[model samples]
Target chain A: MEWIRFFITAALLIMGMISFISAVIGVYRFGFVMNRMHAAGIGDTLGLLCVVSAMAVASGLNMDTLKLLFLIFFMWFTSPVSTHFLSQVEYYTNRERARFMTFRKGGEPRES
Target chain B: MNIDQAYHLLFMGALIIFAVLIGIMLIRAVIGPRITDRILSINMIGTMTICSIAILSGLLHEGYLTDVALIYAMLSFVAVLILAVMYIPAKSTRGQKQSRPEMADTAKEKKLQQSQSGETTRQKARKKGKKA
Candidate 1:
């Protein structure tokens, strides 16, 4: 039983780390800021989710697990808001956005 | 190896990986070209730190570290928010009026009328095309 629990935790932790590694790679390789933001969002949501769940699995049902789960909830709610603001700031400040983004018929900027 | 030793080894390895990843993120933050890129890198580093803290708590069997991780998460959120708020233009009417105090009332009225129309770039382009 102990070995089973250890394996589960290990697997989950590895999965989370893989997600983070991919996210980091994406952030590094992507050409545009908005594309990089997409990569960062992956880490904020999926990477954290998997890592916290792995910790919860390691610790079992306890107050610590409750706290960790609450952390995930907090991140989920706030990450999107932060991403939105970051994009808004980018939109307002980036004068050369035409080079990286395409405009729709309605004047909305979309990734080219 | 025994279960306890195996668990310790797993966590230690994970911690090492996290440390390396965090360091890479730090480099990215330092080299990020635009202000927003730097902010984004900082946000990523904050998240990886939180992950490290949570893993540490599990490895150490201390509940207090979870509390630290929670608080760190909150601080990270606030940091990103404040950084973003700094870049957003303070385009409030009062701010505009205060900045343009020398403008006559009629000019201000005309400006407000144009702003109220909410003209988009597509519309402006069409107007320009017609004028041309």
Candidate 2:
């Protein structure tokens, strides 16, 4: 039983770390900030989810597990909001942003 | 072989991998071409750090570290939010237009696809035949 649990935990944790690795590689490879954000955000959400859930499983249904779940929920909420704000900053600040993306000539700010 | 021993080994491996990833992200932050790139890398690094802390809480059998992870999440979020919001009003106030070039490409693709419907294809074929 213990070995089964360890294997499960190991699989999840390693996968999560792999996601983070890919994300970092993406950050280095992508040419544009928005494209990089797209990569980083997925890694953030998925990697955190994988690792934390593995921790929770190892913890075996207790108060600590509950807290871990809360941490995930909090991260899920914050990640997107932060990304939104970051992209808004990107949109408004990148003077040549037009070179990377295409949009209407003029319109109300579309929700990112 | 034993459960505790196996878990300990796994946890140590995870911690080491995360540290390397975080280091790479740090380098990305350092050499990032734009402010957004730097911040994006920072956000990713913070996220990976939080995961490391969570794993440490499990490995060290410390309840407090769990709480610490929770707090770190909030702090990281606030940091990114502040950095992002700081740039908004100052930049957007200039009435400058920033287009989504990818969107424009997609729109152009859609137009091209629309113009290439079956009837349009047949019409082009007919025109070609007539020319021949």
Candidate 3:
């Protein structure tokens, strides 16, 4: 049973790591800054979710596990909100909107 | 290796990977073009740090790690909020136009020259009328 749990945890951790590294690469390689921000959302929320869930399982159903779940829940709730606000700030401060392909086709400017 | 030992090794590997992810984010935060990009990178690092603390809490059999994770979450929230508020006033102030005196002087000189030329043309026409 312990071996099975370990295997599960290892697999989930590897998956999370791979997603995170890819997100970093995506942030670097993506043309538009907004796109990079989108990539970051994946790594921050879902990637963490997978790894934390696995760790909670490995730790068993105890108080520690509950704490892990709580952390995951907090992340899910906060990460997107923060990302949204940050993106809004970035949009307002910079004139890089032209660089985004999505803005090229008659897109309206956001109200400040 | 025993199953328990394998679990420990797996945890160690995961911890190492998390560390590497944090390092990568730090690099991004350093080189990112804009302030918001840096904030995003820092936020990601914070999330991963919380995960690292959780894992360590398990490994060390320390209950305090959970408390630390909770605190980190709160800190991150506050930091991001502060950043958002800072952006607002700074952005609004940027939109206000404050032209330099030198630029205004040059513009004023060009307008004066145009008006003088127009007056000279009118004066010549009046002299022609007087001659007639």
Model 1 docking tier (incorrect/acceptable/medium/high): acceptable
Instruction: Evaluate every candidate with DockQ and list the scores.
Output: 0.49, 0.41, 0.29
Tens digit per residue, CA lDDT, model 2, B35-121: 888888889888988999999999999888989999999999999999888877543323556543331224443354445443344
Better of 1 and 2 by TM-score: 1
What share of the reference contacts is kept in model 1? 0.72
Give me the runs in candidate 1 sitting further than 4 Å from their true place: A108-112, B93-132
lDDT tens digits, residue span B57-128, model 1: 988999999999999999999999999989886644642334422211334433443465566556689899
Task: Single out the weakest 10-residue window by summed lDDT for candidate 1 chain B.
Answer: B100-109
> In candidate 1, how many Å is residue A8 off?
1.0
**Residue clash pairs of candidate 2:** A101-B100, A101-B101, A101-B102, A102-B100, A102-B101, A102-B102, A103-B100
Q: Which 10-residue window of candidate 2 chain B scores lowest in summed lDDT?
A: B101-110
Give the better candidate number (1 or 2) by lDDT.
Answer: 1
Residue-wise lDDT of candidate 3 within A11-80, one digit each (tens)?
Answer: 8877887888888888888766678888988888878888788778777888888888888888888888
Q: Candidate 2, residues A1-112: lDDT per residue as tens digits?
A: 8778878888998888888888887777888988888889878799999999999988887789999999999999999999999988887676665467664422224623
Q: Give the Å shift of residue A10 in candidate 3.
A: 1.7
